[model samples]
Target: MELSQKRFVTIICTYIRAVNGVYGGAAHDAHVWSLSNERQYMPSNYQNGDKSSWLIGDSGYPLEPWLLAPYRNAEENSLESLHNEKFTKAKSIIERVFGILKSRFRLQYAPKKVVKILNVCCALHNICLIYNVEAPTVIEINEERSNLALPNVDQNEFSRIAQTIRDRIKISLRS
Candidate 1:
């Protein structure tokens, strides 16, 4: 199978929050996110009435009240552009963590128990963080294309709410 066909999805904060490896590479990121147990529980666990917490997702994922995505086709030097810039910067941490995980442990050569292996690696990665272990140097590679299409603006009420929340954040970043 091609490397793209073996894609897995992971959520990371200071450490891995969730990892889903059941989907094949052809699965769209939004589809995976929509069905994830983590996503189901996010409203209860993280989001309350305050709207103080949210997960940052890439363009492949849909915008939701509990999740935020960068504004697509944002104009140059605009507030939306500024938000995307800051969003990219903040999102780099997850990429760096993945780099460290891959560099420290070779996942490509692992056996068929890939999902278990991924979970174990994530756990170990967190342990390294807790103990202050030095991370391996990350070798940057060209990012793979996502299977999902970029999200289009939805006219539904739920989507409008999400867009409003995103707009609030974009405006806040102006200060």
Candidate 2:
């Protein structure tokens, strides 16, 4: 029997920062570990081309596209629209990460032993990835989603802003 290739897995916990709330004893502390990733990535950031870790988001925090406009490349048309869409899509990773974190590891609710449990679960998540180990969990998942509401971004306004961002990015990229 031939052995298959072994793959390594990294446990990533995504969380959002509570800008005005107290979490784990620090105000606006990087409360959500890998959780904050929702607002982190943009679509254009991932080209499936370069190993661009600068924008790869293994760093601290991803800047908002509006503010990150200055760093965009100029040669591409419709870049602003593309980048905005990319950012929105990138945020989805955070959601999926969180969903798995909560459903699989039972990380929901603020428990007194949160950090402790998280450490153990994160380790397990990583381990299972490498061994192709099956994470057999007893918790039965419900079919209904609770929070599926949409954001309040007006489509017309968003298009206008997106266009402006593209223009600005072009100017910045050219300079």
Candidate 3:
């Protein structure tokens, strides 16, 4: 079911690290991401090429040095498939954070200034985490239902490096 006309993008790592992109629902995820301030300034923050600071993204996102997307059409029992499995598992945390946000805030009821409201909600959520306050409820997300099979983007030099990084991680997972 479509949530709303407004599309909100969030980056969560135990806490909501970034909340951005209050675009219309029709906006492509990758397009919104490309225009995000966080994406624009990410290089400066991680100029050292820290392999450990990568972000996990869905197929709708473009693969980049700092962002890892799952392999398209990965064969069963292959290293890519194993990587996808682990990637999905790691990505699920963000999904749960969304579930908690929606359940607690009932974002659907916000009539206007939804972006500001969303930012406030994220801040409050983080504060709750800091104080060890329990969320009143959390919506259970169905991982399979949310999966999108987007076409692979044309590989650029940076994406090629990301592919190598992903391959190294995939191989390491097998050991």
lDDT (C-alpha) at residue 135 in model 3? 78
Relative to the true structure, how large is the alpha-carbon lDDT of every model?
A: 0.69, 0.36, 0.69
Backbone clashes in each candidate structure, one number apiece?
0, 11, 0
Candidates by TM-score, descending order? 1, 3, 2
| Model 3, position 146: C-alpha lDDT score | 27
Candidate 3 stretches with Cα past 4 Å from truth are 1-6, 110-112, 142-155
The sequence of per-residue lDDT tens digits that candidate 1 reaches over residues 47-112 is 456466677777776676777777888999999999989887777766666667778886775344
Residue range 1-175, candidate 2, lDDT tens digits: 0000001112233322111111333312122422334324433344343222322221122232222212233244555545545544554454454445456676554544564455566556656666777544553432222122222335445334544554554456444
Q: 19, model 1: CA deviation in Å?
A: 1.4
Count clashing pairs, candidate 1: 0
Cα deviation at 131, candidate 2, in Å, is 2.7
**Model 3 lDDT tens row, 1-175:** 0111115554536687766647634465666667777677665656765556777777766667688888888999999999999988887777777777777787775434666587788889899889988877658664433244544445477777778888999999978
